[model samples]
Target: MNATGRQTDLIEDYVAALTAALHGPARVKARMIEEIRDGLADTAAAHTGEGMPYHRAAHQAVQEFGTVEELVPSCQQELTIAQARHTARAVALTAPFLIACWYLAQAADHGHAWLLPRTAQLLAVHLTGVATVAALLAAATLAATGALARRMPTPHRLPLVVAWAGTTASAAMAVTTLAFATVSALTTNWPLLAFAGTLAAASHAAVAASARACRRCSRLPTT
Candidate 1:
């Protein structure tokens, strides 16, 4: 194939790969690809010094633009936000199941004692409330991630710092939760409480990190 044909093929492949990697809304993928293509075209124009044929210029431009692997990290800052959204969806889906488990554990512990029925009921109600909150949080995180993905064009250092801080917080929360869960499981203490707390903390941290990463990505200049 000629240089133009080769460049076209490269662009086509790049778009397809981006679509698969992003796995979010079609509009997002389309917009991202369009930006990348424009960037490549501009870079080629600069490289050629004169306006060469589209194919040759484009091919040279793309070749200079580097491979997909190099580009993905820059793109992945936005993708992190998309991942956060997916994570939120997972959290929402898991909420009811977690509540059900909480109830079942309560029942098993209580046996048929018929005592503390009110307490059991209250616990179940509380679990439901927690689940509802989790669902809401998940939805909010997803929406925020989507919005961040749209607005930020390049990676910024400040956002990355914030994201790292969030990740550290999340790691700390996870460790604490794991410790609590271990204690609760071994001693039959507050397993449900520990588990719920851990999950919520971790989810929040993940969302924060994702958002920060997206913001940082927006600051990076495209080639």
Candidate 2:
């Protein structure tokens, strides 16, 4: 085969091997592939300029990138962290919906009259309002966190940490409110309490799972 054909075959072989080894998010795989492709191309050109055949330069480039067997473990670890971060973000996004579910359960039990008591209704109203504000602020911060997947896992800082805190606090408060309401309704509206309690439990469970995942993701080097 010609020099150009040989070089193309080498590049294709290298890329195919790398791709087979990468079991990460599609975006990560694509990004890494592009980077490696350009890097190999550059390295090969440099070797060719130094009196090497194109195919020989390409061979050198492939060897330089390490074998697929060598790359898989490291790539898998990196992508696991990325997957964790992605999961945490998805959980956070569900917070508002979960919070709403809690309210709907309560409304179903008490009709509109359940919230008629000034103290009880006002308290839930205020807490939910706080949760809303916190959730909104947290969203802005959390959006930037996905960027971390491109780099390495580091201890979460700045907006991500703060955003997570806000979300955690909101979920806790919502659950607390649900608990109190459930307890008050235990005697007269036990059936309603059952319904409301179920939804609250679901919310709490989701929050717990999300928090745990985020904590794991936040710790630097989760490998």
Candidate 3:
């Protein structure tokens, strides 16, 4: 009903939507909400001495402060970095398990004959998986770099270089994974190989999507 009440309601709704949309630890979402509120409050404070009505003042404050969508991407970028860090840790932890699964699949397929040395087969599979993971990491890094490049004032050429590198790495990894899976399926009929190929493709797609979003966001003029 009052100006303060209206502003408070708007902030509450915005924060609620943000909390629902952000995907990360609870603390990250809380911090994002607080930062948004402080940004809006600071904008409002700047206009407080202008003698505007409370409702008008708050509306102007929010208008000048910009919308949640604009601010949310920066927060999402931070969340993406956090998630990537988590993925790196998880990859490190579970790599051994994946290696074991590869050997088990190979052994099961071979009727326990042990034609290929188990150690050698495990090493090959580990190398393939590691290469796939490395490609995805390169893609993610390139996408972030591209996004950062778009934000710079002078249009630095390095982000574009990184982006191109990432794209090439992602495509190569996806193709390699698919080819390996196809060969394994035809020779050994291992379905897990197909699954690994799919995972590699999905990771590449995510990196591409992030790069595109970052590029778009970078084009927007800063407040």
Candidate whose TM-score is highest: 2
lDDT of each: 0.54, 0.60, 0.52
lDDT of 3 at 28: 56
Report the C-alpha lDDT of model 1 over 139-206, residue by residue, as the tens digit: 65555555654775423343343334334433433443443354345445455546554664555455
TM-score of each: 0.42, 0.52, 0.44
TM-score of 2: 0.52
Indicate the residue-level lDDT of 193 in model 3: 57
Clashes per candidate (backbone, < 3 Å): 12, 0, 0
What RMSD does each model have against the real structure?
Answer: 9.3, 8.1, 8.3
Better candidate by lDDT, 1 or 2: 2
Model 2 CA deviation exceeding 4 Å by range: 112-223
Model 2 lDDT per residue over 184-223, tens place? 5645655655655565556556555545544544442323
Flag the better candidate by lDDT, 1 or 3. 1
lDDT of 3 by residue, 44-107 (tens): 6666777766666567766775666776666665654444434333333333333444454465
- TM-score (C-alpha) between model 3 and the true structure: 0.44
TM-score of 1: 0.42
What local lDDT does model 2 show for residue 159? 25
